[model samples]
Target: MTIRIRTALLGAALAGTAATSAVAEEWRLNNFLPETRPETAQIEQFAEDVNAALADKDFKLTVYSGGSLGLKNTDLLRVLPRGAVEMSLMWSNYLGRDAPALSSVFVQGAISTVDELKAVLPVAQEIYEEEYTDWGVTTVGFVAIPTLSVSVFCRDEPIHTLEDLKGVKLRVWAREQVETFTKLGVAAQIIPQEETYVALKTGVVDCALYPALYASTISLQEVTKYASFLYPMASAPYTLGVATDKWESTDPEIRTAITTAADALWERTNQYDKDAEAEMAAREKLGEMGVTWGEDFPEADRAQFMEAVSETWQMLAEEAGGNAMDYRARVLEALGR
Candidate 1:
């Protein structure tokens, strides 16, 4: 079944209900990423830390990875508010349709450098907290995603410039990416990460825009022969959110434990230098796997791409309506753009 159909059915079945039992504080943390991913490992550690902190209490945090809870990432905004799930690691880009303002707070290509990302995060988090609270979810803390290098992974030919991308069917992740690439006269579509490898191998798409740090996770190196540097994708952090009602009703000590654990997770992952080092390591691993790397995209073309993506940010904010533009302005102000 399509993700939308599956999400709708699952949402309906669990709507207006608390999925977690009230007898104990055993919370289910839903992670949409695969169990093999490092983020899942970090989340698992966070749960362990929280449990340790609350050792004397009857509180436990169980992490369900790889969508094992039968919950879709896109359905999180709807289900989280109703307490259908007690906790989730939510990425705002996946939630654009339901929480446009939240998505508009930051876009991957909007900030190119790690310093820019660091400068803009506080403002972004403020906006995220506001939006999540309005949606009935309490933000505990955020886990910083590594600032990975984005690349154009193509099958037969290299794509390093705007001209080369014009006729190529490119796979992107978010609507903002689709709009930006489309503005640059490229045909870009949103394909899920799981399907991207097959899309390139079977000629469903000519190329894909993905992070070099994560290409090996889905074995993109096997399908795409040529890869070229695009930009450093500094995406917004993953939010560790709990159903607000559940949070409020919990014991004060347990709440403190959860908060402490979440804060430590954020600190552990927020190192800019570590992010760069990891990306470099991942890129090297991709090369050892028999993938051929192309030349860096030209500075002129990078500038043009960023300009187009900036326009897309504004378009998304206006489309989202209701304080989205204001949020964007605040983000820009933080970046001094």
Candidate 2:
């Protein structure tokens, strides 16, 4: 055989072996919640799509759930950057480390519903941007996971108006939430998810603020007789970030392939979340589950509710960092809001 032909065959074999090695790298994912949650399920699908795109993929990605990896909502910023954990699909509410400023993005009663959220996030992400690059992490833009409307579960009665919220103790997770509720005279009980339900039931908390998904998941509706049609909080927005150190060590082609695959998958992933929420609403509509959405209440009450939400922005901008007078101007320029 000619030397040229022999060299060509050898080069081809080596190229094939390198591709095989790249595909063989397994991705290990970590989750603080149970595998049953929709976020985990959708991530599982993302992994599948990523695997399909690998050239020589031996992709083995196993998800460890329920905080088995020892990371919680609070530890994500440190854990993810240090490579103590690989990837996380958790929300901004859990973070307080690198960006305490991010805490203000969820100012209660300002933005509600997904469309409002989508419009608001571009501004919010800019306020307290995660410094992933410094920590050797590659940030995948925000992911919208399917969750439901925020409802306040109170011991006595659901808050129907700004005046109604007075003298109530409400569980608020974000700094903005605390400020918003406190300004309205509700005592802010700053606590995590696991403790919130018990607080509401035992009277430790006069009220608990959470998504409608929590209503079914934790049975908040059963203990609290009144369900407010008041969905005051924004849907929790989670980021998709990867370990930069690991990513840099990984082959360029693999990174390209994975990112490309993820972008493609996200198109569907977002739609899936929004779609699932619709189904949840449909199920609720089909059955009269004693609960009422504030939108369904009397027209007079609706006018009152609209008036209550109007007071949110000024204070929300103040708590965000500054009076955010400058920001308010910028946002008005950007969104004309």
Candidate 2 Cα misplacement greater than 4 A, ranges:
1-26, 104-106, 113-130, 134-136, 146-148, 155-159, 232-236, 272-332
Worst 10-residue lDDT window for candidate 1 reads 16-25
Cα lDDT, model 1, residue 148:
80
Provide TM-scores for the models: 0.89, 0.72
Predicted structure 2: clash tally: 4
In the order shown, the candidates' Cα RMSDs to the true structure are 9.7, 8.0
For model 1, the stretches where C-alpha displacement exceeds 4 angstroms are 1-25
lDDT of 2: 0.60
Top-scoring candidate (lDDT)? 1
